[model samples]
Target: MYRYRITAEIRRDLERIELLRERFDNRGTLPRRWLGRLRRDLEAESVAASTMMEGVRVTVEEVRRLLAGDTPPTVDELSASLVLGYRDAMSYVLRRADEPSFAWHAELVKAIHDRVMGGAFGLDAGRFRTIPVFISDGSDGEPVYTPPAEDLVPDLVDGLAEYLESSKELPAPVVAAFAHVRLAGIHPFKDGNGRTARVVAALAMYRGGYRAPEFTSLEEWWGGHRGEYHTAFDCLGKRWKDSSDVTPFVAAHVAAQRIQADALSLRLATQREIWTAIEDRVE
Candidate 1:
């Protein structure tokens, strides 16, 4: 469906992600107490960061509290609902990370959008758009990119599904990065396309074995460096353009993966240090 040249940086970053993944996975024998703590912490962080990127107004504190079953912040109703929906969707992705039978398809894409826009306004959950949509600058409201026609949405998605199945020889991170850029470029749904695209990227990383999917926080990295993130997508333009070389976008994605892997390794070590301090004090 799309074509890209894998540059040397892409190869190097992909290799780094895999190496860091192996180093971190060896710590899987972690004490259950710490593992559960880290899992809960990372889940809330992922929800907060991912939703915030999509313009959700809630804070990380509010989201963390919400995940703990507390009442939401006194923000707008949509903010709370959007974050909740995103949390559910992120949880679903993490759950499916290790499934050998999992494959990308149109129905699965619809389902993710459903989770993301379940209670939002002026949008149909889990369905492709029937009209044109333009993504614009948040500041000026000038259109930055125009998606393909509504009539082409279905076929575009079908092409992506086919590509995901056939690209087995490509590096998983590269495949996942392309999947994300294509999904967002297709802009298939009326809403939740961005959130859904990010989740799809996470699914690709998990499927590719880049790192333990449970704890990798690529969203966290993306949210922090959104300028680079948006620029990466913009560098490719939409799928139909003559300048749609995906090498830069894939390179940026692999860079984010490398950052997340290193961050996870350091966090894991820090958690262990804290646990040891507690053990020493108790003894």
Candidate 2:
């Protein structure tokens, strides 16, 4: 219930929460000028993080346009404008959508990858894989990792769906963390597993009433922290094998969120200050 016992998982990160609270509380009493500065700084950081997360080059003006309800520019448009590749451009669009669900998850991943790779991307777009595929390290070209057997996909998907359905009863952060770990552990599809997992994590947060936590670009953060992140999954895989026990994974996930929260809080305070200075001069 409440998305796979997330309370237990969150308990592992209490220290991180305390650190975040301390940072947040320390910035509580700023003057109006300082508040303005903080707001601007937060906006800038938000735009920068968002652009990075989307995996495209986007101008501040383009970001403003997208936020203001202008027709979202296509992946090709983003590629040309930002000088990024097709794959990166599509990743940006996939991550930017605020409302994502399980059904939409399949469709978006397939469409984005297809658009990037030139047609119906995965072996199963809306369906789970029915064959076992080896997950190899790009660096080593060896089949070092293998997912569950074909027969187990249905049960795994069912468990995930049930967990998502029960997520409403959980805390926002816990739900987000659990979703990320569980989905990534499932490794549902052969390709786009990581991206799919990140999108699922974001959707869980959106459902839990938090803004999509753009702590870091998923690819940037995960790619940079690949060793640790993979270690967590590998450790769990060896221990749990079939059943999902995402406690360790959740700990890492929440730690990432805590870092993002701290950065965002400080950035917000700085932006508030800058805005106040500009307003005071104008007045």
Task: Report, for every candidate in turn, its global Cα lDDT versus the true structure.
Answer: 0.79, 0.53
> Which ranges of candidate 2 are over 4 A from the true structure?
1-9, 12-127, 212-224, 238-240
TM-score of structure candidate 1: 0.92
Query: How big is the positional error of residue 253 in model 2, measured in Å on the Cα after superposition?
Result: 0.5
Error of 2 at 87 (Å): 12
Can you tell me which runs of candidate 1 are displaced by over 4 Å?
A: 97-101, 119-122, 214-216, 238-243
lDDT of 1: 0.79
Estimate TM-scores for all models: 0.92, 0.61
Lowest-scoring 10 consecutive residues by lDDT in candidate 2?
78-87
- What is the C-alpha lDDT profile of model 1 across 1-283, one tens digit per residue? 5568888888888778777767877765877887888887787777788888888877778888887878564766777778888878867777876777887789888888888885454668888999888888789988888888899898889889888878878788888889888898888988789899988887777766655644245778888888998998866563345237777788888788787778777888888999989989999
Candidate 2 accuracy as lDDT: 0.53
